[model samples]
Target: MIVIEGLRKAYGSTPVVDGVSLRIPASGITSIIGPNGAGKSTLLSIMARLMEADGGTVIVDELDVTRTKTDLLARRLSILRQENHISSRLTVRDLVGFGRYPHSKGRLTPEDAGHIDRAIDYLHLGDLADRFLDELSGGQRQRAHIAMVLCQDTDYVLLDEPLNNLDMRHARGMMQLLRRAADELGKTIVLVMHDINFASWYSDGIVAMKAGRVVHHGAPDAIIRPEVLSAIYDMPIAVQDVAGKRIALYYE
Candidate 1:
């Protein structure tokens, strides 16, 4: 389990994540949904140690995230940021191979190569494996980044907007991939997303935030309610059971 306590972060004077605490499950997909500037990305960054928190603690299982060694933590958790603008002109395969750095440390063993190949094939990037990142479309580049994150093969994977720029078809495929990663690989997948419907359909839990505070956290059935969503988003959001799943209808 990922345990958070009194976590806080601020950009100079204005605080983004304010004393928020949460417990994320160990082996399922948990989607963090909130409005823009609701501290979703900041909180994820703090949890992954990508950014320093002003106060409080985060513990993944028994290991303290702040105190753990970088390499040690890298082996247990991997994160993909929402905005990754690395201008190195690296190919898809090269970027995915970087994920094995924690274990291989610049030397690619046969085992690491196997992992690289598996991640490429898992994302259906085998055909474009040799394409440069700049050579692909935005959605394809996003998938390449995801492939790199998945190639890490860590127990915990935190993704900030994994579906960004993806078309409907690609978005569905990405969600299914995340589900497979959780059910088949037993990886703890936590994603920060703007799509409530996708969160309801794929994740085991939904964590809603607003104005630097956690408003609600529960199974999709509980969090997808009209009142709950209306309160979190400050607007009317009607939710209904469609087929066998809860679907939100917020668009007029």
Candidate 2:
């Protein structure tokens, strides 16, 4: 389990992630959802140690994120941020190979090659595997990045706005892929998602943040209600049951 205690970050005097205390379970998909500037991405960055927190601690399993050795932590936790800027010209395969650095140390063993191939196949990137990162479309590039994260094969995975630039088919596929990773592989997958309906459908737990604070955290059924949705997003939202799943409708 991931334990967060008083997680706080600020820009000047304005707190971006204010006193967030959350316990993300060891296994399952937990989604963080909120409006823009709600600090959802900031909170995820802190959890993954991609950004420093002003005050507080994040403990993943028994390892303290702040104190753990960088290499050791990378073996246990893998994160894919919203923006990936790779200046070097590299193929999709080359980028995915980078994920094995912690274990392979730039030398590809048989097992590492297997992992890279599996990850590429999992993301349906076989056709684009040889293409350079610059050649792929935005959504395709996003999938390639996710494939790299998966290739790391860490126990914990954190993604920010993973659905960005994805079409409906691919977006749904991404969620289902993460769902399978959580349920079948027993991996802990946490994501920052803007689509409440996607969160309600795929998440075992949904966390709602607003104004830099976590306003709600509970099972999908508990968090997907009309009142709760309205309170979190600060907009009128209607929820309906479709095929035994609660889906939110914010369209006016």
Expressed as tens digits, the lDDT of each residue in 1-252 for candidate 1 is: 999999989899999999899999899999999999999999999999999999999999899999999899999999999899986899999999999999889799999999999999988899999999999999999999999998888999999999999999989999999999899989999999999999999999999999899989999999999999999888999999998889999998
Worst window of 10 by summed lDDT in candidate 1: 82-91
Model 2 Cα shift for residue 36 (angstroms)? 0.5
TM-score of 2: 0.99
Residue 211, model 2, lDDT: 96
TM-score of model 1 vs. true structure: 0.98
Stretches of candidate 1 exceeding 4 Å from the true structure: none
- Return the TM-score for each candidate structure: 0.98, 0.99
Q: Taking the tens digit of each residue's C-alpha lDDT, what string does model 2 give over 1-252?
A: 999999999999999999999999999999999889999888889888889999999999999998999899999999999999999899999999999998888999999999999999999999999999999999999999999999999999999999999999999999999999999999999999988889999999999999999999999999999999898878899999999999988889
CA lDDT scores, all candidates in order: 0.94, 0.94
